[model samples]
Target: MRSNLLPILTALGLLSLSQAFAPDPEPRWWKGNTHTHTLWSDGNALPEYAVTWYKDRGYHFLALTDHNILQESETWFPVATAGGARLQPDQVKAVLESKNPLLEERTREGQREVRLNRHTELVQRFSEPGKFLLVPGEEVTSSWRSPGPEGRGHPVHINAIGLEAFIPPARGTSVVDVLNQVFDAIAAQEKSQGSSVFGHLNHPNFGWGVSWEDMARIRAGIFFEVFNGHTGTADAGNENHPGTDEMWDRANILRLTELKLPLLRGISTDDTHHYHGGKVAGPGRGWIVVRAKSLDLDSLTQAMRAGDFYSSSGVDLQDLKVTPTSYSLQAKVREGEALTIEFVGARKGDAPEPVVFSTSQGAEASYTFQGDELFVRARVTSNLPHPAPKVEGETQRAWTQPVLPGR
Candidate 1:
C-alpha cells in the first residue's frame, strides 16, 4: 500500500508547489456606492432615509456626496419643491413615509422644514464591524465657461469620497487649472489630517463639457465615472463627441503612452437624485464592488486607490483574477440569461483604439496579455436588462479594472 501511494504524494507535492507561485487574492469583495445624495444639498430624502435604503439593499458601503457641502455641520433646510430643478417636495414626502423616527422636522418661521442629519450620527448608527459602512463624501460643484469651441458652462463637478472635510470646486481660466486646484485641496487635507480619501470626476460629457484632451491632461484626476445613471448626461457618443467608453480609451492611451502617467480607473455610479418613481436618477442603477479586508472607509478607499475594484450597473462578479500575464472574471449568472466576455485592450506604437482581443459565451472568460498588448481588461455583459437603465435596450455589464503591461 505504501509503495502504491508514493506516486500520489509526489503529484500532490508538485501541485502545492505550483499553487504557491500562482496568483492568489486574499481580500473579499465589498459592494458600495461612492456617489449618492441626501437632502443636505440636492437629494430629496433625509440622510437617515437614504442610508436606510442602501443598507436595506445589501450595500456594504456608501458615500453620501451632497453637492458643495458636507453633512458634518448642523443645518436646517426648508421644504422645497423640485420645480423640475433640484430637490422636490415629493422626495421629502418619500422620506416622511419611511417613518424613520430620526427625521428631524419642525416649523421654522412657519416654513415647513427638515434638519439634515449629521454625518457623525450616521457613522454611529449604520457603521457595522464587517457588515455595512458610511463613507463621508462631498461633491465639489465647480464650473467655468469654456473659451468656445468647447461647450457652455462646463461643469467641473468632482466627487470626493471619504474626505475629512468639504472640497470646494476650483475655477480657472482653463479646465486644467480648476482640476489642479481641486486635487491640490484634497492633497492638503490628506497631509493636514493624516487621513485618506479618493476623488473622481463626475459626468465628463454632461454638457460636452470636458474635452477628450482635457480628460487625458488632468493627470492627477485619477478616476472618472465611465457610466453615470443621470438621464441628461450622455453615456453614448454623438456626431461630434466620443462616448464614455471611447473617451476612456482615448484619454488612457494619452496618459499611459504619451504622458507616461498612471492609468485612470473607471467607476460607475447611480448619482441618484430623484429617488421617487421610476425616474432616471435613482439608486440601484450603478455601484462598485471593492476588494478589501473590511467594510471600513480606510480599507475600501485603499482598495480603490490600488484599483482593486470593478464597477457594475447590474451584474455582480463572483471572482476577478488579474496577474502580470493575464486577467480573468467569473459571474454568477441567472437562468436563461447569456454572457459575452470581451477582452478589450490595445497594442504598442501609435496606440490603436481598444478592440475586442477575445470573446466568449457563458459565465467565465480570460485574456492572456500578449507581449505586444499595452493593457488588457474584461467587459462582462449579460442579457439581463440593467435594473435602472437610463435608456432602452441596456444590458447588465461589469468592467474589470485594467491590467497594464507587466504589472
Candidate 2:
C-alpha cells in the first residue's frame, strides 16, 4: 500500500527528493576557509593551534592545506628551530595548553622535537558535530617556467579540498598544461575515492605566473582566487598588468563566448601562514560562506559547486537569492556602515569589457535580469575598513557567483 501511494503522491506534486519522507529542509550558511598552512608545511604554528584558532573564532570549517603534504602521518618538529618555519614561544604555550595526549617528544641530534598532531588527532580533538569541522585538504604546490633567456618562472599552486590522500603535482609542458594536468588529477582522485573532491586555482599573480589568457584557456578550472589575504599575491593590478578581478571577468567572457567552457567562479582564501600578528599573512582575512543543508564536507562542497556560496573579506550576506529572472542579496553590517552593490557582467556581443549593469546603495539590493547577459555577478562593498586588511586601503567586501542568463 505504501509503495502504491508513492507514485500517487509524486503525481500529486506532494512527494520529492527533499520532502518524500520528511519535511523540506532548511539550509544554513556555514563559514569556512579553504586555504591555510600549519607546521605540516611552512606555517609557523602547530596543527592543533591552527584548528583552535578557527574553532574559537566561530569558523564553521577549515582546511589545513599544507604544501604538497597532508597532515596524516606521524611527523615531528623541533620546538625551536634555527631557520625555516618553526613554532614560536607563545605557540608552544598554546599547544601545551590544549593538553593533547597525542603530544610526544623525542631527542634527535641533541635537540628536542615535538610530535606534530596528525589530521585524525585534530579531528578527534577539535571536531564538534554541528559547531566546527576540520576538512582534510592539500595545496598541490608546483611550478614551471619557459625555456629560454626570457623564460620567466611561475609558481602554479592549486588547492585540493576533501582529499583522503596527497596528490602529487602533475607537471606539464606549459602553464595551461599544468592547470589542466592538476585538474585532471583531481578528477581522477574523485573517481577513485567515489566521493566529492573540489579543486581551485591559487593566486594567479603570485609570481605573475598565470596570465588572464591562461585562465581563459583552461577547460576544467572550477574556481580561482579572486582575493587572497597573503601579501604579494597581486589581487590588484599595477600600471601594466590586469588585476585578478579583471582577469576573472575577462576569463569568464572568453569561456562563455569563445571557449564554450563553464565560467570559473571566484574564491577568497586566507592562505594564511603566519599565526602571530604583525605578519602580512594571517587568519581572518578572507573566507567563503556556503549555504548547505549540513556542516559536512560533502554538503559544503556540493553547495560550492552549485555556486550557493559567496566569498567575503569582512562583509556578511543574508537572504541571498539567485534566480533565472533576478539576483539579490542583503548586507549584514554594523551601525553606520555604508554599502554598495554593483551588478557587474559581460553582454552577449563582441564588446570585451565587463560593465556595471546596475548599482544599488544601502543595506539591501537586487537586480532583475533582462536575459541578454553572458553572465552577471554581484560585488558588495562596505565603507568600513577591513579589521585585518590584506592590503593598504582594503575595505570589507563580498562577491556572489556569476549567473549565466538563459543558460
Candidate 3:
C-alpha cells in the first residue's frame, strides 16, 4: 500500500506543477460601475456610503467619479441650492456623521462637514483580490457658455477612468476645442504615469452638446456612454442627432466602414448624482457586465479595451459570443416573460448603411455573417418589466457584444 501511495502522490505533484504553468481561463461577468458621484462634488451620499451601497448590492467593482475633483481635501458649506436643487437636511446630516476623524480635526476651526474618504481610502476599502475592486476616476465637467440668444451653455462631461490624480477642468473656447484639450490631457497622463487610463464622452445628447460629427472626428478614445441614467440627458428621440442607441450603430458603421478606425463600442452607465431617493440620476438603471479573467483593474480594463462586454438597461443575457462562424446570443427572461434577440450587422459594400435584424420571440437566437460583411452587432429586448423605462410605457433593451468583421 505504501509503494502504491508513493506513485499516486508523485503523479499528483506533477499534475499540480503543470497546472501552475498552464494559462488561465477567461473570466465571465464582472458587474461594476465606471461612473458614480460622491459628496466631494454634488452627490448627496458620503464616499463610504456610496462604496458600501455598491459593494452590498453585489457589484464587483466601482469608480468614484466625482466632477472635476478627486477625493482629496474636506469640503463643506451651508446646505444651499445649486441648479435649483437643495440637499435634504437628513441626507446632509447622514453624510456629516460618517466623516473621518482626521479630516474633522483638520477642518475643526469652521467646518460644517468633513470628508468621509480620500481617494486612496475609498480604493482601499472596496478593492479586494479577485473579488471586489475600485478604481480612481473623475468626471471632467466642461461646458461651453455659448454667447447667442437661447444661449444655453453646452454641457460636456467626460469621465477620466483609472486616473492617478485629479485633472482640473480643461475649458475651451468651443466644444470641439474642449474635447481636443481633454484628449491631449489624457495622452499626457498616459505618457507620464504609465497607467491604463481611458476617457469616454458622457451624455453626448445632454443639451445637444456633442454631435455625431464630433464623435467621428475625435479618434483618441474608443468609448462613450451610449446610455446614461440621468434625467433629461436625451438617450432617445432627437431631430438632428440620433438617439443614443442609433448613435452607437451609426458611429460604429462610420468608424469601421467609412474612416476605417477601430470599432468604437458603447457603454451603459448609471451617471448617478442623486443617491438618497429622488427623481434624478439613480443607481441600477443601466450598467455594463464585463467578461474578463479577473476582477483586477488590469484585467477589467483590458477586457473593456477589447470590447468584451455588453451594455444593458434592464435585460440580462445568459451568454453572448462572437465567433468565426456566427454571432450568438442567449438570454434569460424574467419568470413567465417572453424574450427576443436581434442580430444586426453591416457589410463592406454597405458603408454608411444600418444593419437591423430580429429574432422570433424566444429565449435564444443566432446570426451567421456569411460572405464579406464589414461588421456585425446585436441587441436583445425582453418582455419583462424594466424598473426604469427609457420613455413612458416602453419595453426594456439589452445590447449584445458587437462582432467586428475580419478581426
C-alpha TM-score for every candidate? 0.87, 0.92, 0.85
For candidate 3, lDDT tens digit of each residue in 85-186? 434446555644653422331334453444457877766656778778888889999888777786778887889888886777777877877877886687
Per-residue C-alpha lDDT of model 1 across residues 1-407, encoded as one tens digit per residue: 25565567558784454454456546899988888987788776778878988998999988999999988887887776436534457766666686434567788677777778799888887888889888888999898887757557878888887687778778798877787688778777877777777788888888777777788877565888888887778877578998887788778777888888777788999898766665668888888999997667777778887888999988888898887777888998888889999988777777467777899998998777788877777788899887665567888888877768676
In model 2, where do residues sit more than 4 Å from their true spots? 1-24, 81-85, 99-101, 388-391
Question: What is the alpha-carbon lDDT of model 1 when measured against the actual structure?
Answer: 0.80
Model 1 misplaced stretches (Cα beyond 4 Å): 1-26, 79-100, 148-151
Q: Give the TM-score of candidate 1.
A: 0.87
Residue 161, model 3, lDDT: 86
Tens-place lDDT per residue, model 2, 212-238, is 889888665579999898976888876
* Model 2 residue pairs with clashes: none
Q: Model 3: how far is 307 from its true place, Å?
A: 1.2
Which should have the higher lDDT, number 1 or number 2?
2
- Please report the candidate that would top lDDT against the real structure: 2
